[model samples]
Target chain A: MLDHPTRIGRLALVGLGLIGSSIARGARANDLVDTIVAIDRDPAVLERVRTLGLADHVTDDLAAGVAEADLVILCVPVGAVGPVTAALAGALKPGAILSDVGSVKGAVMAAAAPHVPDHAAFVPAHPVAGTEQSGPDAGFATLFQGRWCILTPPEGTPPEAVARVRGFWEGLGSVVETMTAAHHDLVLAITSHVPHLIAYNIVGTAADLETVTQSEVIKFSAGGFRDFTRIAASDPTMWRDVFLNNKEAVLEVLGRFNEDLAALARAIRWDDGDALHALFTRTRAIRRGIVAMGQETAEPDFGRRGAKG
Target chain B: MLDHPTRIGRLALVGLGLIGSSIARGARANDLVDTIVAIDRDPAVLERVRTLGLADHVTDDLAAGVAEADLVILCVPVGAVGPVTAALAGALKPGAILSDVGSVKGAVMAAAAPHVPDHAAFVPAHPVAGTEQSGPDAGFATLFQGRWCILTPPEGTPPEAVARVRGFWEGLGSVVETMTAAHHDLVLAITSHVPHLIAYNIVGTAADLETVTQSEVIKFSAGGFRDFTRIAASDPTMWRDVFLNNKEAVLEVLGRFNEDLAALARAIRWDDGDALHALFTRTRAIRRGIVAMGQETAEPDFGRRGAKG
Candidate 1:
């Protein structure tokens, strides 16, 4: 923040959900912008944002929200990016930078870049952090602290605009990294999308079991199923749009996941204890690497017992 | 430990790994036992246990370790339970009670019940808690606090002996529950065994992906894959034996899980957003139920960032 190159005169945040509210709270807390405009399609959400005093202005009209904004960030579900961008294109200030907090960068770029104005710069970013909870009520200012915010700016993007966006995220307490949109989608397919699908699938599977009652599963979840439940409990609308928009990458990685899963099933069926042992041992090193890199906590049982409200 | 029953005169631990060492430490800290004997087949482990002052006596000889002990607990891998129990069957004191800490209940009962002398009692228990760690150095005195310890007593076991074993686990900071050995297998297969298998399979899948490098997966694991990695990194030999010995129940629950996953995949392919949303919402309730039951943490992100060492 000490070496920040520029400040946003007016920042417009569309879709006042968890990500958008956190951005508003962080900007206000740090005084990164002179004025904040919050917009959401749901009138109830706009009312809640106003009651929370999360922005200087709250509105349901998109054009009015972005009329004089120097920076506009769309925080809606991935499937809504095209329509939202098209609606704001006519009202967006010339030379203003437009960005989004979408999980799938390639899909967002493809859907939004066409609607962007010629004078304005469009940068797509994905912040790799969140809890299972969602909505404006679930947001906090420090959600992005010590987390990675990946920016996927398309070709011919202005360097100054990109740096401004990077500085904006850095001011909000995030480390920024730049990568091609295609690479971003591929990496996220492995790290986020497939993992989420598997979690949802497993939870659904456990629920449908005839031999075990659902109450029993909940009572004894500390064994391991509790972790999957946390991941599966994420916002459904956002995740559904993510899978639908990023179909190719998600399906491709899922295919690879299935092949590996089949091999493991075979190992268990044929009593290949050595293969299972070797694979399990190799995975321990990966967990150690994540802990050492500060990506995950080294605390036993995820420090669940010592958590504060 | 106040208002406890008769004190343990001599307690013998058959394996000096995480569970056994933890029992030794817990017993010594609470003054619940007079003499603690630590037994391990590996001389190095025995030497380490002795160096740590984790036991009153440490030895590699099975006969010498269990001599005149009032309580003996087998803490080895499920596959080794039968052999360890047979070896100590003749050495156990006439009135001593024998127990084990194995995930699979029915198999442990079958493997060790035949070796129990008429004068000695055999009980099988499973503590539904653990970190992604193992070995002597990984144990602590309070590992069982706020955790569920299930004791599966076979029919015709003496009621007085069952009460004594129940009191022992309660004294070590666990809430104890008793059920038939057959039912315990089904419950654990759903709660622990199948969950571990799925975690192991998914971690292997991520590791084997061609589109994403292993290092990239580790770097971005905070997205969701990191949670699965913690469960998959558990002791390999112990899990291998779990799936092998509890084959029938694990396979049964696994079949149900596969069917559910296939249905979910179909929903995604057909773009049934409602179905996906409904399932995701239902799973959220299960997670909430777990938090309410005090089995899991309600803290966001498992309170990983604020954990103490």
Candidate 2:
């Protein structure tokens, strides 16, 4: 009802998966947008979106979906951003803002920039939140509550467009931060991309071990491997695209990880308990910092004990 | 009132940390033991144990603590098992069942077997359960519910002793599995030791990154690094001992991990999205197995969203 630019007359969400569906639900719950137009190439996804009543209008046609939308947010995999943007860019209303929820900003910005029309703004975003689950059913209205949403607007982007996008994320209960697309990719490579790669790699290694039975790994996973499995179980297509797109930063960080792991392996082999203890002790402080910053739960085992039921 | 072999007249737990105190609480809660004698070299731990009423008797004297106990379980770190066992073996009651809850069974068996008297039985156990938090206050009665407890009784051990130890674990709500000490160490090296080592290694890697600010890592940890931090935050002394004692199996498994990771990295560098997708998809089956087997919670984000309140 307010005349502020933050309020959207029509918001178009491309792809009705977890992030896209959650954005639709959150926007409606927060009254940040008057109407939502849900679009997906997959007819099944569009049907599901209609059944769930996630948006005011649903369609498989990209151009129709974004026809009159004041804002369009691409919530598909990073690899799909370019093609989807190109297909719908001409249909976008003049002065509309184009944003996305992709994890890697630099690559997404590169892919999406050329397709964005001069009349529209492109603001790349990465919400640092998710469950291992995927699909529309996996998302909730509160998925982004108390989580960080990073925005990386390309150079010369209109400040008003970025503000409106930031305001939309803030309305969905996210703390917004701004940085360069390059810096965002670098930070996320260490914090997210490489971590996921290692988790997937280790789970694969455990699965392929000749001496250990699969049943044994599955049964005794609670020790620590199960934690890795949770992240490793994340959406495969999305993660593959993440690694494929953010190759440089992920490889750079992974190289450091391998170097550090080699030293730890050496220390263990040589019975350097003090070295192991020191590193182990130092790592606890980082966990404490994360918990203290409200980015993680202080509850033991992520409060899984009570959730066991 | 039950006269089962699992019932203990006096059970001595040699350390009052997370695992030890949890045993005390579980034993008392299920009425598996008549009395628990809590022993620790640290006065503060003994005081905390007493204040929490975790055991019937609390003392710093290892010898005095196990004087007439029918079952003596060494609950200290694996590195301290030898010294603690040697210090108390002579004071053990005749025909007592000597056992432990160490993570690495083979090393613990080698350390404690020589000191144990002929009249006693040495049963090494590794309960595949725990949280990151430690100390008496962090212990809970339901810690081992629906968890696995692996027992590695050395050859020529009395069947009655193994049965009693197995029965005791069952009373604590654990499903018991018996295997050779060597296999237990190998199984645990992959399932627990190396997972923890890499978790510690990656967390250290992130903390030491010159390019990324520590504040940034802490702020964006929800992306996946935080799960690693949970396991990396475990007891430093205990984890150090696990790595040192289980060196051979851990290094062997770690070598495999490094090799697998190299292949995964190559796939990423060369843009083999198909290979990355195949591995990522395969790992999700293991997670489903863990959850189906009741070793993990099926809830998303470990049900942390609801716990946030």
Candidate 3:
């Protein structure tokens, strides 16, 4: 028998896509949960979940799928959380914990908190882990290993309920952290949303340039542009929902980014090497900090062979 | 004995930095050159190069280093290329090929072209491969393996000299391609220069944010920001020169990028999910094209285990 703690009786995962399927796989791999009930609005997704044996019971009916589940995780896009949470609000059992794996915590809490019953716990989470791929087949059992899963529980959320959700994420091999919903949204805007927006915008810009053909861009992309494309290639629906739901914080960070870019452009145009060197030196320190903190690989050349595997 | 074509009787690398050291190591590994002479303005770097045995000989004299070399490769910062090229112009032997590994081709060609003796060939080349690390200790023999090495030879330059340089790069395990100086600049402006500027700008912006502490940004950077930091952490002197030398192309691409980003920001503000989704989907296809073209890896989760080694 595998040695593990905090075994969940039944876990209901809504939206059987990347995160949902990964959670299902992880839960099963560690025997973290006894029963996994998968739910998705798309019938084809339900079929795939059943085929993969990802869930003990796969169903289209949200209420029926989650009725017996002790832990219910909403894994839909950020924009869909409000409607989806409302749809299943009547079904969650008393004392059962409810949570989500959405990128924008504020919007998720706003949409789902209204429908969360007084008797049930609602904890919002954002797992800072993923690949460029999406959908049911794109998930694996160890996606969350050594990654962060941040929980943004509401002001009056019960401590015990928060612990349960944290325990569940830990069971799935994540380092758990807690913060406020608004702070989570703000922090993620800088770390994820703005970076993603910049990547998407740059890729679009590169494609539309008349001087350079798309073939050339694709051919020579190994020189840093390809890195942006990987982040830009993330799921359309998911990113769209994230930007729409977190517009406030995204706009704020983007405003700052444009200002900084303009200043750097001026520095370059005026040939101010000192300013450029100082900025580069500061940023290099940040990369070192990230690597030292174990959030990034210390390998050189992007771990060339490792990237191939 | 390793069999490699276009063997160099005497090879001189002008700058014992990352690219310079890597070339020395690669030439030694493949036995592509019989004698390697490494030169650098910094005495410490030359001492380190000598200590590492990366080159058969190390010297601070630019002229003495290249006088006996049949192949002289300038591996200095873009800003230093012109001055260094002029300094060594008299030292290159008749019919010897002079080349550089600078990121910007037009500026390099312009700076070094006027100084090239009629008897020698000046073929500008750029190997689109690197790690964020710098200096002699960070280089390895396999750095250029499977990487693209673009050559932009001036019009009417001897085809034999271009072919010889191409053969040498191939011996080091690089795929070589030839393009006009202007086209190379435009292509790289989109593929490299603009991306580096954006990464540097974003890291600077994140560092200045009062709402989010630097520690928080660094902690949560695994979400996406860390990737930009890697590129931003590249050599400051090299990139500063890249921007100054390639100012027009960089500004043009940066303008387009800003416009596209404004549109994206508007889409988010207006909640235009369709527009956002359409653009995101299109960019996704481009990434697939790059991966299919073998410029990128198809591995999942940033190839976590591979990053370790």
Candidate 4:
């Protein structure tokens, strides 16, 4: 925003859910784009998007939406990336920059590149911002503020196109960074994917316990398990799709996490308090680092929308 | 406080640390006691007790403080229950009621009851409330509000004594529940101890993952590890004492948790999405149950005492 013009001649959102709607809000609020178009298969969703004024035009036809747009951002789940790309390929304008907001970069590129127009540039992005909530109604214009948006541009993607996509995100108040697709996958595997899986796994584990009742698990979650439940409560469909699409990355990180956790279990089983205490002490520094990084705002409530009460 | 009595004559806190000072604050706020006599070897902590307006007198002599007190509450770490009880046994007043706020009840009662005077009543209590903070400065009067205080009085412990302890807690706005020490230990092993240990374990693992890098872990902690770090940042001395005192119970729950987690890890390794989704979906219902039961406030936070920025 400090450097680029706040005007997008044409914009196309290939999916109209939370991320897409959030982007729509950001673009509109910053005057970053004009004559925006949105596409989703669900007529009801399209109707809601039109009513919400996330885009000037709403359509089920992906091709029609991308035909005259300067940018087409795929906001669907990772698994849908391929099909959406194929559907919108021929209609994408010459020199158009195709981007996405999927959580996994390698998977997104793998799914979308073959379908990308030969003359168009493709920039794959994963913005490190979201709430447990979903749907167009849940989005707000400032959702991306102070959050990281990593762009993974495959080799040979033109710099100009990358700059345009980066500029668009910058206008939305995000700090944009570039990373190789492989590195991005690794970083996210540790930061986002592993954490989500751990949360999901722990909650699942608690649910399966016979001695400790579910009601009890719920009742005293303040001890710590409650945090996992909140993350595990995230939209299942999105997560299901994420795991399926980022299988290699998620599984890879999960393997390391399990190894790390099993070692910890061994320590606790052996009553290795020194090891436990030492590890815990080191982790305290990480929390300080997170507070320093603008990625997480540590106002308690763990950066969720609001306080529990 | 619907059934609570009018006042306390002489209230004695067996330790003047976080829980003790907090109890002192709550008692003072409710005008539950005429005088608060605090017993702590740490003169500095005891000296600051009345700064929080929770204590009227401070002494390093446990026996002297317990003398003339009708209500004596042990606020020492679980491991220290034995020595503290022995030191104060000869000094407790006739017909005095005794209780504790230890996380582990069975162990505390086992260690403390032998030293109890025949004319005095021993009621081991655990208020399911705390913050990561410690010492007198962290004491707050509202710490017990809307929280649970589980009183595990020994069989044949005077009913009148139990009622008085319950009344004291109720006056502080805590909902009092009665359970056997064994049941209390088992429930707490899962609800509080295991979860806290798991959090400490995961945080430790993240801290030691030199290959993954610390800055990366901290920056991306918004994903999940940040929550664990927060929990693990809790008082090291208190947690060390918990693990040492509640050894058997914590180990029992840890075994169950590991078995369940192993099953989940295998399922993830096998890419069994059905199993994962089924468990994930089941867990969400439990969270809803927590919210519905008011165990977890429906607000996004778990009722942590913090403001959202």
Q: Which is the leading candidate under TM-score?
A: 2
What stretches of model 2 exceed 4 Å from their correct place?
A305-309, B305-309
Q: What is each predicted model's overall lDDT from 0 to 1?
A: 0.84, 0.90, 0.88, 0.76
Q: By TM-score, how accurate is candidate 1?
A: 0.95
Q: For all the candidates, what are their Cα RMSDs to the real structure?
A: 2.3, 1.2, 2.2, 2.9
Clashing pairs in 1: none
- TM (chain A) per model: 0.96, 0.97, 0.95, 0.94
Write model 4 residue lDDT over A1-309, tens digit each, in one string: 333553578899977777899999989898888778888998889989978878888899888888999888999888788888998898888878899998888877887899897988898988877766678887888777766788989999898888888888988888788988877777777777767776776677677667667766766666666666766777776777777667776667666666776776676667787876776666666666766776544554343333232
lDDT tens per residue, model 1, B52-91: 9999888888988897898899999999999889998998
TM-score (chain B) for candidate 1 is 0.96
Model 1 misplacement above 4 A: A1-3, A306-309, B1-3, B306-309
Better of 2 and 3 by DockQ: 2
User: Model 3, residue A88: displacement in angstroms?
Assistant: 0.9
The 10-residue segment of model 3 chain A with minimum total lDDT is: A300-309
- Alpha-carbon error at A188 in model 1, in Å? 1.2
DockQ of 4: 0.44
TM-score, per-candidate, Cα-based: 0.95, 0.98, 0.96, 0.92
Specify the poorest-scoring 10-residue window by lDDT in model 3 chain B: B300-309
Clash number for candidate 1: 0
Q: How good is model 2 by TM-score?
A: 0.98
lDDT per residue (tens digit) for residues B175-260 in model 2: 99999989988899889988999899999999999999999999899899999999999999999999999999999999999999
Per-residue lDDT over A93-143 for candidate 3, one digit per residue giving the tens place of the 0 to 100 score: 988888999999988888889999998999889998887888899999988
Ranking by lDDT: 2, 3, 1, 4
